[model samples]
Every structure is written in C-alpha cells, then in structure tokens.
Target: MSERHVTFDMIVQAVGAVAGITHHEIMVAGRAGADERVHLRYACWWLASKMTSLGPSAVGRLSGGRDHTMVIHGQRRAEELRATSESFRLSTDALLGTLQALERAGLLRFAVTIDPLATARRVLSAPEREAVRVSTYEIVAMSRLIVEQADGDPSEPSTEETAHAA
Candidate 1:
C-alpha cells in the first residue's frame, strides 16, 4: 500500500462531503445551532484524531481554531454516539471505509512519523502558529477557487487563465 499524508483538511472535506454539508459549515467557529451540524463537526474531529498523526491541539487548530478541550469533548461525544447509535456507527464506519479505500488506492496520504511533539516542533511561537494557521486557511480557499473554476472538467483552463480572461 502506498502511503500518503492525509491532512486535517482532507478529513474535514471528506466529512463534509459525506454529511452533505459544506466545509465552510464545518470549519466555521462558534457553536453550531443544528444538532446535525454539531454531530457532523464532531465526526470530523473524531476522524481527524483517529486518522492523522496530528495532536489534539493541532487538530483543533486546523478545525476552526478550536481549543484542545473542545476537540476532546467532540471526540468524546462522537465516541458516545458511536457506542449508542447503530446508525451513527454505520455512517462513521462507512466514511472510515471510504477513506481507507482512498488510502489503499494511493489517493489519500498519512503522516510518516507519529511524533507526539510534532505540533510543538512545527511552531516555535504563538504568532508563528497563527501565521501558519492563516496560511492553511488561504490554501484551502485557493483550492476551492481552483476547483470551482475547473467545474468538474479537466480540460478547462487553469485559474491563472480564468483570472487573466476576467
């Protein structure tokens, strides 16, 4: 099996796709008013925690700048739902299975080393960390723009072409 670094963004996108919600809805800060939205967000957290090498804080950072405690709570809620709800378990399991399939197909990637302190080592200062976080958001936004411009067709011109034409 080929290894790929499955990013936190990938998990969020996958969860959003599976749940029929936008990634924006999942990543938006604040308490989601809808139970479905809350549960989907929790599922994203649980999946990211389980699937990636990122720590809770890193996962939280990638997930709408949430606190580690909030990530932990979401994880716990997800686990509780999985234990008690067969439908929830089946859905999550299906999502997990889809990700696993992608991994096996060499489409999805995962971290190489499972370093516990990786998050700490990645950012030396709070300002640096925030910068990195902002960059991530920008990257995601750019990706969305590119995808939107592509419009499900690979033969389409690139983003630059579209921009230049405008």
Candidate 2:
C-alpha cells in the first residue's frame, strides 16, 4: 500500500473529529477564555509536534500562522493538562495510539512539507484572512521603519510606497 503521509491539515481534522468539534472550530483563533475549544487547539498543537518532524515555528505556521512562542506555550499547556487531567490524558493517549497503529500498518506516515500561506488561504475564514493581511502590513511597516532608521531619514517614505502612490 502507498504510505499516506500525515500533514498538519490531517492532524487538525483528526483532532476535530476526536473532540466532537468542526475543523473550522479547531482552526479558528477565538477569544481567549474558558472555551473548551482552546484545550482542543492545544491538543492539536501537541499532537502535531509529537507526530511530525516539524518544529514549533513550522507547526505554528501550519496550524494558524501563530507565533512559535504560542505553539511552545500550547505544547507546555498540553503537557500540564495531561499530567493533571486524567480524561485529557486518556484522549490524547488514544489519539496517539491510533496514529501509531496506522504508522505500523503502513497506512499513514508522519512526514509533511506544507506551505503556510497557501494553507492559510485555503482554510482561513474571512476574519482570519484579514488578520493575516494585517500581520503582513505590520511586517512591511516594521521593515520601512528599519530602513528609515538606517538611512537617517524619517521623513522619506519607502521607494516601493512612493512608486505605488505615484
């Protein structure tokens, strides 16, 4: 049988199925609070990190364009929850066991090369897309600020912006 490699997309879908949530729910970055979906997101992060060779940054990008630090924090939170919550531990263990069994059966392999922006465009809702757009703008603004500082000319706009404005 051809080995079906696991991707972050698959992991998110699996976690959503296991948690009785929709993939959209899993992918959405909702407001931080006592939402149960947050735990599910953390679980997805933990599972993707453990099951794949992707680093925190890669996982973060694939998951939701989140920062690597947030991924790391989610991983730590998953560990803490596993230690303290028996139900959470059991659920995670069951999911891990299922994936391991698939690996052994040659049904699935843990390898992926994902394009974060492409995945974001495919999976993100309008609001999420807007968030990514704003992030891109912020990065451009920071770059312009750095260039201005280096050139010692705060009044001058970037050449690219000037060209666009013309």
Residue-pair clashes per candidate: 6, 0
Each model's TM-score? 0.64, 0.63
Best model number under TM-score: 1
lDDT by residue (84-120, candidate 2, tens digit) is: 9999999988887787677677786345444534544
For candidate 2, the 10 contiguous residues with the lowest summed lDDT are 140-149
- After superposition, which runs of candidate 2 have C-alpha atoms over 4 Å from their true positions? 1-4, 31-34, 116-166
Deviation from native of the Cα of residue 13 in model 2, angstroms: 0.9
Runs in model 1 lying further than 4 Å from the true structure: 1-4, 29-33, 109-166
Instruction: State the C-alpha lDDT per candidate.
Output: 0.69, 0.70
